[model samples]
Target: MRTIAIGDIHGGLKGLVQLLNKLEVRDEDELIFMGDYVDGWSESAQVVQFLIELSQKIECVFIRGNHDVWCEEWLETGEVNMTWYIHGGMETMASYDDFSDEEKKEHLAFFRKLKLYHLDDQNRLFLHAGFTSMHGVEKEVHKPTLYFDRTLWELALAMDNNLDTKSYFYPNRLKHYHEIYIGHTPTTNFKCDIPMNAINIWNVDTGAAFKGRITGMDIETKTFLQSDPVYTLYPNEKGRNKD
Candidate 1:
């Protein structure tokens, strides 16, 4: 069976559908979504519904991204934070306008059930954000996947900038997996690859919601598929939030 992992969708439902159509996924294929499934675009509800339908046909794994976590929190408590809403939560909230209260509750339930990270039996790890501490310690830290508890992002940025670095692995004894698929940080090149021992970490958040292309990677084949460029809802753009 072919195993394909898609990067942060970020409410680009049309892009997601287009990419899936291009891939022509089959019943036996396994599709893993790296999360951030909602927000940043105009079709959050549609995206969730589409994934729900797709889950019936294929083995799909959904992991929660930072945006998704914010969505859950806002939906549950009605306490929206500016940081989250400014990033992408506004579009996600607007996507549910057409849904009834019950439907919204169901959607929130789905979001809450999403895993922070996923590890296959083959040792391939998929997460919306990179592990701050080591992978094992991630589950122990409160808000491990979403919050910036450690310096992994800082270290990654330093490394990417060609600065000197210390040891690559954290002290938690979680061996680097074959490859870690992550999204969250937007990269100009559209993709970034970092090698750590036997593992290769790939960041594939191409900023689709910012009029950029959405990327899909075939894990087994190590190939990529991209979507056409689309317009994005600019911040403070009047009427842009209409569902």
Candidate 2:
């Protein structure tokens, strides 16, 4: 079965749908979503509903992003932080403005059940963001780092395959898997549109939250697919203005 890893969606359900249609998914193909599925465009709820349906057809692994954490907290405590709202949480809330209580509950459960990271059979690590620390994926992990850290990517950028001898990068922070695929930091930050690889680290978030597109990669084949520019997909909305 082919293993595919998708980057952040950020409520660009149209892009997500287009990308999915472009992919030739087999029944046994494994699909790993890197997270930030909501909090962008005007289709957060629609995106979640689409994923719920998609899950019924394929084996899907979903990771939780920081935005998703905010969403989950809002659902449980009814607290809305401006920081989150400004970063597209407003759109997210509006997307669910009409959901029934039971539907909201199901969505919350889906978000809560999302894994922070998924280690595939090929030993590649798929996460929404980088990990500050890991002990065989058994130790306590900080969710923030898992959703926002770029240090790992920076480290990977600075080092070649000889990273083992680097002065920094503790053994705990060093690479231990075949590869680590992440999505929190967009490739637009690096002025690119395609997925990027440094050493064994892959950054697939093509800045869909800003003006880039949703991207998916077939890990086994190393082939990648991307949607049209996210801005065009939602002419009336701008997700997070990171620039």
Candidate 3:
């Protein structure tokens, strides 16, 4: 059975559906989503509903993201975080307009149940963003660091490719896992619209919130598939590309 790691979705339900169709997922396959499932396009609530149903039929792992945290708070408290609103929460909020209070409550429960991080039996790590603990995610002191840290990716990008893993200069955090998969910082930020490998860390976020596509990768083969650009699917909307 293959294990697929999916990138940040950011409410691009069309892209998500397209990518999944391309994957032709099987019951034996395990799907790991890197998070940011909502807050960009016009179908945030639909995306959540689809995921909730998908998880029931497929083995799926969901990682929570910063945007998801903001959304969860808004859903539970009814107070919007200004920064979240400016970044795409407004669209996400509006997506729920058709839902009843009971439905919203169910969605809130889904968000609350999302994992902060996941470690597979192969010692591979998966998280929405990054973690700071040099020892590993299990020792992370600040919970937010699991989903908000960028330093882990920065370090991976800056590290010398030839650095020996056994050397004293190697990063302890990197040594803790055979591979790490993350999806908060979009690969599009670096001008790449595909999954990028920096050392052993794979960044799967291809900027679906903006003009990019939703991506899915086979964890073992590193083979991946991407949907058509998300903005193209919702041509009438700018998504998060407003300038």
Pick the TM-score winner.
Answer: 3
Candidate 1 regions with alpha-carbon error over 4 angstroms: 134-140, 146-174, 189-199, 232-243
Model 2 regions more than 4 Å off: 134-137, 161-172
TM-score for each of the candidates? 0.80, 0.92, 0.99
User: Which tens-of-lDDT digit does each residue in 152-200 have in candidate 3?
Assistant: 9999999998999999999998999999999999999999999999889
Ranking by lDDT: 3, 2, 1
Order the candidates by TM-score, highest first — what do you get?
Answer: 3, 2, 1
lDDT of each: 0.68, 0.85, 0.95
Which structure is stronger by TM-score: 1 or 3?
Answer: 3
Model 3 has a clash total of 0
Model 3 TM-score relative to the real fold = 0.99
**Residue 27 displacement (Å), model 2:** 1.6
Q: Which stretches of candidate 3 lie over 4 Å from their true place?
A: none
Q: List the residue pairs that clash in candidate 1.
A: none
